[model samples]
Every structure is written in C-alpha cells, then in structure tokens.
Target chain A: MLDEQDKNVIRELQKGLPLVSRPFELIAGRLQMSETELIERVRSFERSGMIRRFGAAVRHHDLGYTANAMVVWDVPDGAVDEVGQSMAAFKEVTHCYQRPRHPGWPYNLFTVVHGRTRDECVQISEKISKKTNIANYRLLFSTAELKKSSMRYFE
Target chain B: MNLDDVDKKLLKLIQADLPLAPEPFREIAESLGIEEAEVIGRVFNMLEAGVIRRLGAIFDSRKIGYTGTLCALKVAVDRIDEVSAIVNSFPGVTHNYLREHTFNMWFTILAESKTKLDEILDTIRQSTGVEEIISLPAEKVFKIRVSFELD
Candidate 1:
C-alpha cells in the first residue's frame, strides 16, 4: 500500500540504475524529496515487500561461460523442502523454486544453471541430483532468450 | 504498456529477434504490411508504457566469463530489506527476491572470478551483518535459456 510518491521513487529505481555516485539521490530529487527521505521510503517499500530489490544483470554471453539451463525436478512434497534446501546449497543453481506443476510438466522443483559448456552444465546437474537424491529430473535448456527485465510494478 | 494491435505485433516480432539488417525495423514493417515509422512508434510506445522494460539483448552467462552461483540468506524477517540492499549493492549480484521459507532472501550473482565472488559474498555478509548467508555454488548445470515466443 505505497502512496503515489513512494511508487514514483520506485518506478525510476528498479531498472539497473545508472552507475553514479548518488543513484538514490537522483531518484529522490526527481520524486521531490531529499536523499534521506527517499532511502527511508525505499527501505519501507522493501520491508513491506512492495519492492524486491535494486540490482544489476551481467551480459553473460559477452563473458564466455556459454550454456545455461533450467533444471526441473519432481521431488515429493515433503522432500521438496529438503531437496530444494540442498539444491540451494550449490552456488551454480542461480534460481531454485517451487512452481505449480502443469499436466505435461511433472517437474515441480526448478532451478537455473549456467556453465562454460553443455557437458559441464550437465555434470553440475548430475552432482545436484546425487546430493539431493533427486534421481528423477529434467534439464530444459534455453534455445533463445525472449525477455529479461526487472518487473515494473508502478506500470 | 498501452499496446494496440500493431504494437502488439511489434512486440511479438522483436520480442524475439531484431534482425541484422541496417534498417531492421523497416524490414519488420514491410513484413507486417505497415510503415517503418509505424513499427518504430509501436515499439517505442511499448517501451514508454513499460510493457517493454528493455530493448536490448539477453545473455547466456556461461557463454560469457561469469563464474558464479545462487545463494540464499536466512535473514530474519525484520532484516530482509537490509540484507537485500547489501546483496544488490555488489555489481556481481543480480535477481534478489523474498520468497516463502527460512532462507527467505534469495539472490544470484555472476562473478568474474572465484576471488571476486568471495569478496562480493564477504562484503555483502559483512555489510548486511548476516553470518547465516549460505553460498550455494552450483556443483552441476542441467539446462539453460528461454526461447522467446513470437506468437
């Protein structure tokens, strides 16, 4: 339940902000508030769960790692927590979550993995499987990127 | 975004590929039976409306030099925002969120090197004052990439 002023502050800050000295101050000035007030309001929004974060995204392919994949696993409801906990323990698993399963999509627990090559990525997945006792899982690789951006709640 | 049919069409098309031609937008317009200006207008409109958050390329981190992993911070509910701010401060970190469960604050980072990664993690932990931060380095990679849908 953020008021309009707070929302205005967020709309500008969400995008991987300009790499400047006073990033928060820039948005604050735009919102007609001082830097302290702006940061406080933002902290409130975050504390209230209205704003998730302020972060940057790297240009992956430009760096040379290569393969990235979505690794999904069908763990039992009770084991999902345990297995997901174990999976999250691995630095390679960029994202791990419990998603609703579709009729054709039996894998409920999901994770994203990136590696230098397909073989290396698969090897990492296998290691996760061994650690979590996740004998059954599927790796869905991205053939192409569609859209990737920070969600704009204000819009 | 306040997208009309034509704008939606532009989104559907470039939502995937923005071709290699010099005047790619014009080519897209020709294919769509519309003018180049019309295509540009729609795309820009989508961008302004925030339907198109960014008009650029997405990357495959592994294809690049990013050597990193995902980690979850078991932050107290009261300190979630503080932890998130610290995590987000680092150039290496991206994608931070609050989800249900003990390790509530989840985040991902693509470090240039292991030493850099450790430095980023240590700095975040010290800044956030959260010793419970767990760095889950991916022991394996299974699959990656999301192919966009033009349809």
Candidate 2:
C-alpha cells in the first residue's frame, strides 16, 4: 500500500514529466527529494506493477487510427481463456477482457480494436473470429468520444 | 504535421518508457543518434499537433486499491450531449464514448472502492434517469496494452 508521500509522488508524476535535459531532477526538486530517490521510487512502482506504463499516451485518432471498434464475442465459458489469449496476440487488439454476461447480453469477451479505416477494423475482427473460431460476435464502433481523460488518482 | 522517420522512431521510443536517468532525453538521443534538443522539439511539436495526449505514468488502478467498471447506457438520441455532460463532470468517469449500439453511451469509471463505484453508478443513473445502465466488470484481463506502431 502507498503512503501519503507515495501518493504525492504519483500525483506529480501523473501530471507528466517535464520536457528537459534533467526532467527527474526538476520533479524531485519539487517533491523535496533527491533525483536518485525519485527515480528509485518510480522504478519500484514499475517493479511492483503499480505503474502499468510510464511513457507517452498517444492519441490514436490524431495518429490516423480513427476507426475503433469494440468487438464482443460469446465464447464458451471454458474456452474464454484460450480464445481471449489468441485474440489478444493480434497487434490490432489493444484491450481484451472477459466480463460477466448479462441477461440480454450474451457476449462475454470484449476486445477493443483500432484501425485506420472502418473496413480495416472489420477485417481485423474477422481475422480474430477466424483464428478463434468464435463466430458469435458483434462490433460496436464508437461514433464519438464524449470524454477521454486519464484518471486523476488521489486528487 | 507530417512525421518523418526520425519522429516516428522517437515516438516509438518515448511510447515505451523514458530512461530512469538524470538526463533521460540525452539517453534517448544516444540511442536514436540525434540531439536531445531535437527530441524535445519533436515531442513539443507532436503535443501541439495533438498526436500525443500526455507523457506520464499510467498507474494500475487495481494495484493502487481502486476499482473500475465499464458501463453502457441506453440513452435517447436527443439526450446524448446532456447525458454525456453529466457523466463527464465526474473526475472518476473516464473514456466515455457514444458507440453504435442500442446501449449507445459506453464509459469506464474508476473509484477508490467497489462501494464508491456503485455510488457513482447510482448517482449517474439517478441524474440521467436512464434505467438501462449495464455495468460490466472484468472477470479477467487478457491484455491491456496500447502501443501504436507508426509505419
């Protein structure tokens, strides 16, 4: 568990690292710690899996990856793990997860696929279906991004 | 802005992780065989172009004692903007989108606890008066990596 000071470090780091020759030095100066201490703390966080990633958050739309689809599949309960891992191996799939199926919603496996065009997204989904042999699926394309912001933890 | 080969390479490098060094950019410059200033300048330009949303640490909410869930609401066509505004007002509500489906508005919310998550969902339901909100919590995460290869 992170203490108050660790939370403070996270708050500062999440705002983003300064673009400079010695970015960590500047951040550590503000955090009232040595540069080495700050780096070590971040490294520890990375090692402990607290920090999922520590780098650029690229906007896919801006990068011409405008076509994004949420492809949900109804994989057999026992085969979900196998099918999910197979689908996740594709470079096009960014996020893949297994969620509980609702009364009316039969799809339990979800994967968010990104492509440059709508047809490209469809092709990727088709490819995944072919590989997984799970034909029961539906692609829900996002019409608009109402909001897309990083979670501000400990705020 | 057109991205040259160097910018593409620099982006790919920065997308992974900045080196844990006194001068991280300098380390990156060494790998790419470019001046540190060039890297900083390219990143600045990319930021201006909105190619890079942010450059920071992405914490695992679960590891940090936070609970998150994806929800889809069956909202009426005319109420999208108003409903979205209400949903987006909350700080915990992130990645809200209007998808092409019956349950049009889909979003992911992260809260400090499961109770907090339920509270937020209840509040959103009450505020929007949209009864058909389905909360889908992940039972297992197969993959959650986002990296765009600039070819």
Candidate 3:
C-alpha cells in the first residue's frame, strides 16, 4: 500500500539506523514523514506478521555466555515426530526445526542446546536422548561465526 | 492503525527504549503526555496485530554463555512434518531456515554449554542418519540487529 517514495524513505532508514536518543525522530526528519506516520506503518507491518519481533540483538560475548555449539540429529523416519516434539520441550533449546538432507550425511533432525558451560550443554543433550530414547546424532561445534545480520526490509 | 497526535508521542518514547521500569506503562504514558492506559492500549493493539512479537531482551547467544551454530541437514522428503516436530522439541534451537539444496534441512540451535551442545547434535545424528551436516558459525557479526526508522 506504500508508494515508491515511502518505501525509499524506509529503505534509507534501514541502511543506517541511529543509535541515539529519539532515533525515530531523526529518521522521521530524513524520511519527511511525520513521526506519527512512520510509527503507524511499523505498527501495521508488525500486525500483518511481516515484522516478526522488535527488540535488541544482544551481544553474547559481552554477556559472558560465550560458548556456542550446534548438534545434528539422525532421527529415525518413523520416530521423528516423537523425537522432534520432545526436543522442542527442553528449556535450553531455543530454535528447533527440520530441513532437507545433504549428501554423505543424512542426519536431518537438528536442535540447539545452550548452557553456562560446556558441561551444562552436555547434560541437557544427555537428558534429551534419555527422554526421547532415540539416539543417532552428531555435534557440529562452530569454530567461527560467519555472518550475523538483521536484514533491512524496507529497502 | 490510526495514528493520532498522542499515539505518535507514545510510539516515539518506546521506540527509543522499551520500558525497563517497574511501571513502564506509567513512564511511557507520562512521556506521551497521555494516560498510562492510553500507552498500554497502543502496545496491546500492536501485539494483537503481530506487529510486536514480544517485549523482552533478545539475548546474544554467543555472548550469553551459548555456543550456537547453524547446522543444515539432509532430511527425508516424506518425513518433513515428522522431522519438524522432532526438531522443534529442543529449546536451544530458536531459529531455523528452509532452503532448497542438497543440505536441505537448515536449522539452528543455541546451547548453554559446549558439552551439552555436542550431546544434542549427537542425539540428532543418531536419530536421522542425515547424509552430511555442515555448520556455519558466525565469526564476525557484520550487522546483527535491524534498526528500523518508524518515520
């Protein structure tokens, strides 16, 4: 429903967001929209589900929770449901879902476990296996963080 | 989505900082020069519309004692639904993606501790028999958060 000009304005804002007091006001001034109009659109986008959520993307390193790891599951075809569902219930598990498989490695099911220390993560993983009773997975620990982004939408 | 003068004022305040106060509503209301109820009303509307998914801290896993990674798996075609249910069971994995490629099952997990993260991955491998799993962890976060211009 937005015209090209409106979209452009938002696009520009997306590129360079100010980290200051009254950030929106500064954006509004550049976009030439009354602060009110911009807020309306943002609110609308969020309501429509286009904008999932709005909040700070915290810095894990600064927070002192700096150990990260990824674990892959080779769940049985028939028992995927039971296993996946049970994995979703873990408190430490944050993002859990399925994807298509790759070659030479067919372990498709995946889940992430987090803890204050490596030992804690291991305990949760063990507990998950015990509860599900279906084991056959691999741990792919991240040696590097390639790209972390909060993609620009309007532009 | 009617934006009156007052609603504009309310939004400007929160856009700066989500209420971190005990009576966040009161502080926001005062800033907008409106009643506390008015500010809450606008927030409620946004939430109902899906504009606001949540009002909480978006933690950085790597910094917050979480050793997280993005792992892609080769899942069986017929077992997509079943696989989703199985994968969603873990809490560490908060976000994932569905891409079109050999390593199709693209997912992520945020683990609290390293040993536990390994264990979780092990569990998955034993369960799925995925062809190959590759992880691309973030090394340098070029840009992590989206800074939206409400205006």
The best-first sequence of candidates by DockQ reads 2, 3, 1
Better of 1 and 2 by lDDT: 2
User: Against the true structure, candidate 2 has what lDDT?
Assistant: 0.91
> Candidate 1, residues B1-151: lDDT per residue as tens digits?
2345675566667655554333556677888999777776665555555555554324334433457676666788777666666677665665665654455666777775688788888888778888777665655433332322222
The lDDT ranking, best first, is 2, 1, 3
Off by over 4 Å in 1: A1-155, B138-143, B147-151
Docking class of 3: incorrect
Name the better of 2 and 3 by TM-score.
2
> lDDT scores for all predictions?
0.61, 0.91, 0.57
Error of 1 at B149 (Å): 4.0
Q: Which regions in candidate 2 have their CA more than 4 angstroms from the true location?
A: none
After aligning candidate 2 to the native by TM-score, how far in Å is the CA of A139 from where it should be?
Answer: 0.5
lDDT of 3 at A123: 74
- With a 3 Å backbone cut-off (N, CA, C), the pairs that clash in candidate 2 are none
- DockQ of each candidate relative to the true complex: 0.02, 0.87, 0.05
Computed on C-alpha atoms, the DockQ of candidate 2 is 0.87
Q: Model 3 over residues A1-155: C-alpha lDDT tens digits? A: 45676456546544433433344566667878766666666555455544434433333332334554456677777766667777876666754656445556676666766666777767777788788885776655544342334323322
User: Per-prediction TM-score, please?
Assistant: 0.52, 0.98, 0.51
